[model samples]
Target: MFSWIKRGLLVSTALLSIGLVTTGTDYREVYAEEPLRLSKSVYEKPNIYKVDESEYALFHAVLPSSTDKYIHRDVSSAEVYTNYLLQFAYDMSMLKFGETISKQIEKPFQDEILPKLSEVVAETTNQLTENEWKQVKLSSKPTNGSGEKIFHLYNEESGEDIFRFHVRRDQPPKKGHWFNFHYHTFLDGHEGHHNLGDVYWGKNMPPKWMA
Candidate 1:
């Protein structure tokens, strides 16, 4: 009879907690099953953008000044490697050409130069181990507004440039002007010029870079 009375008190306390068998007014509104109300939808944020790594293109490059951002030793993804390589090249090109020239040359740069970027980046990164690949980085502070120096990919530890990308305004005698895109590799002592093709800008002299 004493054990039965003790069990009755335990069952009564459990029912009183969740408003199912409320003992007072305080417990009446404290039902555990009711959902909490919200002022706004949880997914309604204006500042968020989602990027898909698989379908993503290296169309525009951001965060050019990031320093020594390693690619990580264990990552062997081609998308990760090419995205860094191509985007940095595009970023440097934007810095060199600025708005007007970069827009006009975007077509040729995308078609002609992007292929070379893919080809060369694949070739180079394929030959290296993941540790060596992670050491490679895109350097910052490209020559601004003018000059052929866009940027270079370098070894963060050794501070040596592996590739140098450049652009130059070309005018052959009696020919239309062109913006020439090219790159140099350390293997050739930076002497050999590997062309990435050019965009014709007509007979008139184009505005200076970044103008």
Candidate 2:
């Protein structure tokens, strides 16, 4: 009887360890259970616009003057152009959500908001001219609670990524349920662009659209 009880305990312990290794360790299994369901509807129109040399110069002037060696040499020409697109999205999200939006809302935005945005931007690509940014693609499966979306804005012909945008969102607790958003742009091998700040929407956040 004693030997049988000891064996039973050992078996139970082995099964518990196996369950932890299989279920508790793999993130994919967890995500599968709560599978992200991104909607495919467009919430707002894509605001496609151009940034000429003068506009670019004005934008550049506002950035912090950096004497860093990487800043001087590695800034890509395409980055100068894509900055406008990033700015457009940032401005529009702020206008729609209000001015005090926080980072905490990023999960809801990803699960409930970004799918529609992905569709709108993809559709808008057809209308863009050769000189405009093209082939905008989501770079990876956005993770929940990450507060950001990663995108690769590719060049028209070369298929190379001209720039990538890391768009982050948050909503502070007890802050009227508002959401804040901002993005950092990386030009291929270069560090992120500077001086661009965040936008917010507090207390006046629009109702979430249900599909």
Candidate 3:
């Protein structure tokens, strides 16, 4: 009887140790399988608004290539080309804005915005197969408010304005900051059609004018 009791005690001790080892292994496996968490600062969505023609004329402006009598006959095709150009500008702006936000820098526009913009313009002009007629000129000015940067783009030859971009802080501080940008297309000489609405960044909902 004494021998049997001693064997039972030994068996119980061994089983307990095995159970502890299994529990520890399970815990480690769970920890290894856990997913990594990312902060909002790491990923930001591109908030782009559609070009409103009522506010600006560029949305309906015809490309120089499309102005030929043969191509102009196809009104729908001309409209499509115009829309494509506007979309292109919108896309490039969004890409630049997204990169700027990701860096989370205080004065990104002043530091490196122009060169980056120039690079984008060069690549885009090449892709469009456009000659120097479509070349872009960039300029910036300080706004009356603090922490604001306003940029303007124009046609290199005609000197007609292309677009205006404003980067500013939100009122009351808690709402954060964002970008407001609009595009325009030259009509005759000095006049150009302006977009009826502007695109905004960092907001999911459409702007008041758009809504």
**Top-scoring candidate (lDDT):** 1
lDDT of each: 0.55, 0.33, 0.31
lDDT of candidate 2 over 153-193, digit per residue (tens): 55434655544434444456766543333333332143544
RMSD, every candidate, angstroms: 21.2, 21.0, 26.6
Worst 10 residues of 3 by lDDT: 1-10
Task: Indicate which candidate wins on TM-score.
Answer: 1
Query: What TM-scores do the predictions have?
Result: 0.62, 0.26, 0.27
What tens digits encode model 1's per-residue C-alpha lDDT throughout 74-173? Answer: 3435644455456556556766677777767766676677667666756655655656665676666567545788777777778877788888889999
Candidate 1, poorest ten consecutive residues by summed lDDT: 1-10
Give the candidate order by descending lDDT: 1, 2, 3
Stretches of model 2 off by over 4 angstroms after superposition: 1-152, 165-167, 188-195, 203-211
lDDT for residue 188 in candidate 2, whole number 0-100: 18
Candidate 3 matches the true fold with a TM-score of 0.27
